[model samples]
Target: MSATAVILQNRFSNDGATILSVAVDGRMVHESWNHTVSTNDARAQMIDAFLDLWNVYCEQGLVLYVSSRTVRNLLKEQQELFDGLLIRDTITGAMFRKTWDVCSASHHKQRREKRPLPSEIEKEPTPLVVVATDASKGKNSKTVGLSAVNSCGIIKTHEMELNSIFDAELSAINFALQQFGKNVKRLEVLTDSRQAIQYIQGRTSLQST
Candidate 1:
C-alpha cells in the first residue's frame, strides 16, 4: 500500500500549442505527445498513465490522488478497472500541476516534515459571519420571495418573478452571497432546501421543464 499522487498539466510548445503532460509524485513520468490533444483525449491519456502505474505498483494496495474532477468521475464510471483502487481529490494535485518540477524538490521536505496534504488537514472553526437563506412562493403564483439573514441581525429580501421554487431558493443563496460574500473572507451558508444544496454541491443538475 502506497500514497501516489498524479497531476495533469498543460504544456505550451514553442509554437504556443497546448499539450498535455502527466506528473507522478511531482515527477514528469509521461509527456510523449508531440501533437495537441483534445480535453477528452488528454483525460484518456492521463487515465492510461495512471493504470500503467497502478499495474506496476499494485502490490498490496494503492491510494491515488488526482486533482481533475472529470478524470476522477471517469475513473469512477469504470468500476471494474479501478475496483481495488482508492481515489481522492486534493489541492496538492493542482499545486503539483502548476509546479511539477519544482514540487519534486519539496518531496524531501514533505517527508522530513511529515507534512499532511491540505485536504487531510482539519479545517478551522466556523466563522462568525453565518447566514441563513430561504425562499417562498405562493401556490400557482409566479411571484417569489427571497430572504437572507445573517448572525448580525441583518436581513435582506428581494421579490422576483420566477418559474420554480428551486430557482427562487438558489436565487436566495446567490442573493445571500452577494450581500455578504465580499465583506467576509469566510461565510457559512444555511439553507433547508436539499435539492438546492445538492445542485450547489454538483451532486445533481437543475433542469428547466
Candidate 2:
C-alpha cells in the first residue's frame, strides 16, 4: 500500500501575510482553514499554539510546502514544538499523535550547502539592550521566564513565580527591567502578552486612566 501523505500549498494574503493550506493528492482540505484558532500571535502561550496545530494533525499526517523561507521556518518551529508536547484533539478531547514534514525536498540539504553563509559582519554592538519575557502555568505556581541580550554579547536568564501567565508577563517585564536597574539607558523589551502591553501603556479597559 502507498504511504498516505498530505500535499500542502502556500500563498500570500492580500495583506502580505502567509496563508497555508493542505491537500490530499490535489484535493483541498477546507475543514481546517476555518478552524485555525486565533492565537493572538501566541508565543508565550504554547498551549494556544499547540492546539492550533493539533486541530489538523490528528488527521492524515501533514507535509508543508512553502515558497518563503520565513514561512517555512515558522511552520517548522510550530510543528517541532507540537512534536514535543503531549497533546489531544481539542475538539474531540482524545489523545493522539501524527507525522509532520517540514518543506521536504530531494537533495535539499545538499543544495543549501552550495551557498555557504557569509563571514560575520564587522560592526559595533547595538546600543540597546533587548529583553524577551514569557510566562506559563506550572504544577505548583505560575512560572515566568526572562531572557536578555545586550549589544556587548552579554546574556542573562531569570525565573520566578506568579499568580498566572497573565500576571507573569507583567511581572516578568518589570523583573527584566530591574535586573540591571538604571544602568540600561537604552533598552528594548519584547513580550508575547498583548494584554500586558495594553495594561502597561494605559490602553486596557482593566487599567484606569
Candidate 3:
C-alpha cells in the first residue's frame, strides 16, 4: 500500500515559525512555513494547514505517513484532540518504523547495483479548509460550536452558547475565518444540521439578514 507522510521540521516555539514537508516514498511533495505569534494559538493554525494537506492525499487514495516525533509531540501538546482521535505514540512509532525499514532496504539494494535512488513520488496539491458549524437554542440560551477541518481531521474549533444558537454558530465561524484573513484559495462550509448547512450554503435564505 502506498502512503504519504508529513514531516514537521521545526519545533513549536514563540520565536520562529513552524515548517512542514509533505512527502511520499522519500520524495518531497509539499512544503510550507507558518509564522506564529503565539505558539499555543499557532497549533490550531498548524493543524488546519495539515488538514488541508491531508485532504489532498485522501483525494488520491493515499494513506498518511506521519513521523514518530511529530505524532508524539502532537499527542503530548494537543491531548484533547489526540485522545478524541484515539491516537497513541506506539501506533505512530510503528508507522514510521515501517517507513524507515522500507527506505533503508531500498537504499542498501540500490548501493549494490550502483544505481541512483528512485525518484521520490510527488503528491497532489493541498486542498482548502472546510468549516462546519452547529448551534442549539434553549428557551433563553443558545449553544454553538464550529469546526475547521479537511479530509484528514479537525484543525480548529470554536464553540459558545448564546440566546440564539443559530446566530451564535454563524457568528463563531465568521469570527474564526477572520483570523485566517483573505486570499483563501477555496472553502467549503458544512454543518451537521441540514438547516444550518443549507443556510450557510445559500440554499436557504436568512430572513432576518
Candidate 2 lDDT (Cα, whole model)? Answer: 0.46
* Candidate 3 clashing pairs, residues 3+ apart or interchain: 142-162
TM-scores of the candidates are: 0.38, 0.33, 0.30
Q: Which scores greater on lDDT, model 2 or model 3?
A: 3
Candidate 2 residue-wise lDDT at 87 = 24
Per-residue lDDT, model 3, residue 89, is: 39
**Tens digit per residue, CA lDDT, model 3, 1-209:** 43535444443345655554444545555555556665555556546645665565544534443444555467457545422223233324556555445544443443334423356433433457565544445575455555554445646666666555567666656654664324456756555655555677688776322
Extract clashing residue pairs from model 1. Answer: none
Ranking by lDDT: 1, 3, 2
Write one digit per residue (lDDT tens) for candidate 1, span 139-163. Answer: 9999999999999889999999999
Q: For model 1, what is the alpha-carbon lDDT of residue 130?
A: 91
lDDT per residue as tens, model 2, 88-118? 2221211111212322231232223433235
Once fitted onto the true fold, the runs of candidate 2 whose alpha carbons sit more than 4 angstroms away are: 1-127, 151-153, 207-209
TM-score (C-alpha) between model 3 and the true structure: 0.30
